[model samples]
Target: MAQDIGRVHVIRHLIEKSRDRKIKKMIEKMMPILLVLAASVCIATTFGILFTLVFETFEFFQRVSIIEYFFGTEWYPFSSGNPSFGVLPLIMGTLKVTIIAMIVAVPFGLAVAIYLSEYASGRTRKFIKPVLEILAGVPTIVYGFFALTFVTPILQIFIPSLKLFNAISPGIVVGMMILPSIISLSEDAMNAVPNAIREGALALGATKLEVALKVVLPAAFSGIIASIVLAISRAIGETMIVTLAGGAMPSFDFSVTGSIQTMTAYIVQVSSGDAGYGTVIYYSMYAVGFTLFIFTLLMNFIAHKISKRFREEY
Candidate 1:
């Protein structure tokens, strides 16, 4: 019995030593390659997407002038005589929808985050957060269908001219789609505020609301803003909901009641139909996609910069 016990101890020590050495070597070997691999993957993916968009966009621009694509008000590439290829209308439509979405999402998302982080009990927060995440996990196509089938009809009650697929419903749904992202991020930021700060605020005789609004919120402002910017970028890049719900007609008007097409919607419309390669219509999709890609990229870069500059210290 004594001999066996000694052998087991020796074996366990050997195994522990082996594991420690293995883990240390793994970390040492991986440390350098980690950043390189990350950068390489990012560049590769960016280049792949950018290259395809640029070449296709270049082909598109050959048929359509840069000026026309940028400043043109009408977008009817399929129409006959005097077809206008102005991309401004589509840009305006995208902006209108995004603005509406931001308006709907930001306040509610931030409020929910504050409530969850500052007010909710542990049990309530645990339950509510999963439910919120589930909201995000719902397939966007379902939301698109809901917008088309339900939201538009509801809007039609107030606005007779509202089409089967309009910006209002989809924009609202897109806002809902992005709400969980914003809330989750913002709550994380809020929760990162040190307990000492909260206690100090309470020590100063400030109410919970006052402490949260004036102290904790300010401390976490950078993270909250970063979350908002990221959410905006997400809204701009959203495709399925906008495509399935927003009507596929690119227009220059800023009216929410009117049917308008986003950059993503336009791409989907073109890609859905049969257009042979090397055709103007085919190239046009690339050009629109390139434009959308650049727009989203710019937003992402800005958001990244903001996040880096304002990321929480601890």
Candidate 2:
């Protein structure tokens, strides 16, 4: 009876091992299919958005003159009799805010990144990095309100000409909003430089700052530029901050103190029940959105080209 029990246990063990192998093989086969399905979903969603934007924008151009829309300086889509659809003013407003944001974000972010990557102790970096990332996660609407209420008031004391709802305040807030992207990406890029290069520079009598600036900065140049480009894209696409703080008036003026409207702000305004469905104003939103998309796409393309051209291999 004991011999018979041992034989039976051996047989059951072999069966369980075979069943485990079959389950493992089934999982391996299913993984590829699951990954492909996920990719397909993303691709389908992108195409759906593109199709919607293109069709509506094409219809808008049929009704409105494309030449006027592109080149005209005025943008009064709500005008009772002759609603001018010149997109130039909106473009200028966007550029003004973007330029201001870049000016504020680049220097401060780069400085923080350099310090974090090259100078900070591990414990300090661990604490500060999370704080910076948390800043990035703060709701943009909160930034807008902060710009509208707090920053604007502070600026008014320094620049009496600054309007309550102007480009400068929101631009500064937007800069703060995008600071984490610059800091995190630039720091990562700087850290990716080989320690051997730093050691060699140090052995040659270079100071810590010198090695960081000359060796690491050059090696990470592409990444820093890419981060800046990404920040610019984020600034361009930001809506709530500009809409709430930058005012609703679309102006051709480039003054930072004056009120102006960005493309995203205009979209929000029209979509807020002011423009009826299927109206020209409604359709114009798609045109502006497409234009914004083109700008961001162009920036991304440039970033990709720059990274490819200047990427350094270890």
Measured on C-alpha atoms, candidate 1 has an lDDT of 0.87
lDDT, candidate 2, equals 0.92
Task: Specify the highest-TM-score model's number.
Answer: 2
TM-scores vs. true structure, each candidate: 0.85, 0.88
Tell me the tens digit of each residue's lDDT in model 1 across 1-314.
99999999999999999999999999999988997998899899988988898888887787889998898888998886766688888888789889989999999998999899988899999899889989999998898888888888998999898888788999999999999999998888898889999999899899989988999889888888988888888888888888988887877776788778998888888889887778788888888888887888788888788767766476
lDDT of each residue in 1-314, candidate 2, tens digit only: 99999999999999999999999999999999999999999999989989989999998998899999999999999999989999999999999999999999999999999999989999999999889979989999999999999999999999999888899999999999999999998998898888999999999999989988899999999989989998998999999999999998988876889899999999999999578878899899999999999999999888778767656464
Alpha carbon lDDT of residue 146, candidate 1? Answer: 84
lDDT of residue 119 for candidate 1: 89
Which whole-number lDDT from 0 to 100 does residue 4 have in model 2?
Answer: 92
